[model samples]
Structure formats: structure tokens, C-alpha cells
Target: MSIERVEIAASPCPNDVFILSGLILNKVLTSFEYSFKFADIETLNELALKKAFPVIKVSFALYPEVYPDYQILSCGSALGFGVGPLLVSRKEIKELNFADFKVGIPGRYTTAYFLFKFFYPKEIQKIFLPYYEIIPALLRGDIDLGVLIHEGRFVYAKYGLFLVQDLGTYWEEKVNAPLPLGGFLVKRDFPEDKKNRILQDLRRSLKYAWAKKDEVYPLLKKYAQEPSQEVIFNHIQTYVNSYTLKLEGEALKGIKVFFETLNFKEDPENFIWENKDGIS
Candidate 1:
């Protein structure tokens, strides 16, 4: 019988590429029904919960509600795990008082978007956009504040923008949890033996990526959509954690608090996905 295949839905950016690119470039294909698919952070979420990719699904994990559905792994860095949604304003605005401010978060459905809902519930105005447009809108004064993701985190400072809020800091002080950032994940439905093998392969892939960081940058240049090497490199460095380890406790705590504070409530038991080893 022909071997089965697995598809990977990955966020198409340099940093996200760090986790899955080794598998693509080196082609250490896992022993399972496997193939790979790339998707943005948004589309990846929609596809993940449907339990589409049983072997591996490389995507971002923003909300706690997402954890129980998949067995997730580290992305290298922990403190950066909660790099906090940046509050960028094109103007000279120095402070963000949650009282009467309008902040723009991507799509309002994003974990960051809902995060704003929890932290600044008193803010008078809030807007959502496709992320790429938020900075332009801020430049045009279409909005007062832009909560940027993707390459903006790397370039906003260069544009003379000022940050008003560090949501990551807020999360840490509020819950003492390392901010639950994004990382690689494998679906839970995968059979145990195959799942263990994929997990082992992933661990190897992560270690290899870190060991060969210098070689991985150029491979991601096309995906980050950045023409500037500096920007692309920075983005990759900023978002790609080593991915060669497990998530830490502080980060887990923050991840827990993020879910608890959200009004979109979910059962706590499901927050931790169970593995074939009967462990969460």
C-alpha cells in the first residue's frame, strides 16, 4: 500500500518558516500520511480545530482555547513568547490611557484583539483591520493606535512610531504567565506510534534549524514579503524561538490567565491537550 500523507498549514512568514522550513528544505518527511500546506495565522486557526492535519500542523497558538485541540511545542524563546501586542501610533502620542482611546487590532477575532478587549475594556474606541493595513491607516490618521503583528513589530520603530502599551507586560503583571506566543503543533488524532515518531522528528528538526540558523534566513526571505534583508532578518529573529524545547511554567500561567479573563469562556480542563502518554 502507498504511504499516507500529512499536510502542514503554516503561517507564511520568515519567523514561522523557522519551525517548518527544515522539513521542507531538508525533506526529512515523517513516516505518516503526510504533505504540507501553508496558511496565514487566520486561516491556520480555522483549519486547525477541524482536526485536519493529524500528523502535524504548523501554526500560531494565540488563545488558550486552542491548546486542548492540539499537542503544541516550543518555538525557542520564552520571554518573547509574550512579546506583547505593540501599540504603535504614527503621531507623537506617548501614553495610552484606556479611558478614551481608539486602538486598532487585527481582525478583532485575533487573540491579541480579544486581549485588548480584556485589558482596555474601558477604551472608547476600537478598530480591526487586516494587519498589513493598520500601519498605513495609522500613517493616514485613520486610527489612533495600531496593534501590529507580522513585520510591523520589526519596522515600526524605524518609522518613528511610539509604543503606548506593552500588552505582554500587562499580561505578566496581571497573571505572571509567560505570554502564550505562537509555535508548532501536531494534531491529537494521530496514532500514538506515528505521533511519537513525528514528535521526535520535530525535535530533531528544531535542533537542526537552530544549529543552522545562518543557512535558514535566505530561505524565508521570500515568505516574509520584506524586500529589505535587515527587516526580514529581524522579523525572523524576533518571531522564531529555538523550538527545541518545551514551554515553561511562567508562560503557561500567562496563557491560562489569558483564557480565564476572556469572556468567550471555555472549559478549563480542555485547556491542556492530552497526549498518547496520558499526560497533558
Candidate 2:
């Protein structure tokens, strides 16, 4: 029998590449066959809304729009303490007037954008750009402030950018829990058995990558924005955690609070897929 091919999509960030490297390279053993596609989180978010792929990585902020069609997998999540996006400026700026300053956001649907909106609450001029483009735009004076996510969080200081605020820290302090940035989403119509199987495979892939970090480093480096191995490892170390293996306790609570903060009425628990075979 021919192996069934399942389409998968995720960003090329170091952490994502590190976690999914095993699956991408067939290092993890799984009966299921997966085809991988790479894109920025924003484009993936748009594709996810159309159910373009059965499995995809998406920002937690985009969850509400795709919740009806997608159920979040327990594994492959990007959540942890001190792992939030940063709002940066080229130089030290004393006053932050929304009307006077223009902010560049990676994507409107990203958690970075959501956190900015949640905290600022004011209608500011936001220029949407790809994650990698934000820093360049800021450096060129295209925008007054930029919301930096992914690898940008690690290297902003090198660019002489001053950190105005750490959105992740604000979230943790306010919610008293770690922030859930993004996670894996599968179509709601996908078979539960297959979904559970895929979930287990994903957990196995994460384990494989962590155990064989050196082996996967090249693959991670291949897709990394920053060439430094230290930065790549730091990115992986920051985002991949126990929550990536399973969503429980404070991680689940944090997600609930985030949804509630956005005025989402549906029960957050209903959106998480519970693996009955003890995969979660």
C-alpha cells in the first residue's frame, strides 16, 4: 500500500525548525507520511483560515478566526516564561504617542500584534510587514517602532535597537502565567485516531531533536535567520518546553485568559484535542 501523504506547514524559525527537523528529515519513526511547507506565520495564518493544510503552526492570536475549523494539538506549541515579542525603536524615545508614532507589526494575526493591541488598546498606525522585514524598515526609518518576534527577539540589541517593552513579560506579569505564542493546528474534521497518532509522532519528533541536538543543528541552521549557532540554540531553548510536549496546568490557563481577554466567548478547553491513548 502507498503511504498517505499529509500536508504540514510551519515557520522556518529556529525553534520550529529544531522541533520539526526530525519529522522533516524522517529521523522520527511514524507510520504517517508528512510533506512540509515553509512560510512566515502570517501567511500560514491566512492559509490556515482556508483549511489549506490539515496540520499547520499558527499564532495563538489567530486561533479565534480558525477555531471553528481547526483544533489545536497538545504538542508542538511555542509557550514559556520570558518568551514574548519585543517592541523596539532605533533610539531612545521618551514619549510614546500612538497618533504621532507609526508601528510596524509582523502580522496583524500574530500574538505579537495581539499583545500590542491588548496593551496599547489605542488605534495606532500599524504597517504590516514580514517578520524579517520589520527590523530593516525600522533601521531605514520606515516605521517609528517595530514589534519583533522569532529570532528578532534575540538579536535586536545588536542592531542598536532599544527595547521599549517586552510583551511576553507584560503578559506573564498580568496573567500570572507563561504566554502561549503559537501551536500546531489540525483540521477539526480530521479523524481523531489519526490526529492522536500524529500528535504522538510530533512528541516523538521533539524528543528526537532534543536528544540529537547536534545532529539536527545543521538542519536548524539551514533555515535560521541568524547564522550564529548560539542564537539558534537559544531560540530553541527558549520556546520548546514541557508545554510543547503537552498542554496542561498554567499553560492551558494562560491560553484561556488570553482568549477571554479578547472577548472570545467559547470555552478554550473545547479547542484543545485530548488524546485518549495517553499521548497528551
The candidate that achieves the highest lDDT relative to the unseen native structure = 2
Query: What is the C-alpha local distance difference test score of candidate 2?
Result: 0.89
- Per-residue lDDT of model 1, residues 171-277, tens digit only: 66777566655555666555666556665556555666777877777777767756587887766566555323455455555545655665435543343332346
Model 2: per-residue lDDT, tens digit, 159-227? 889999899998889889889899999888988898898888888889999899999998988998897
Off by over 4 Å in 2: none
Per-candidate local distance difference test: 0.60, 0.89
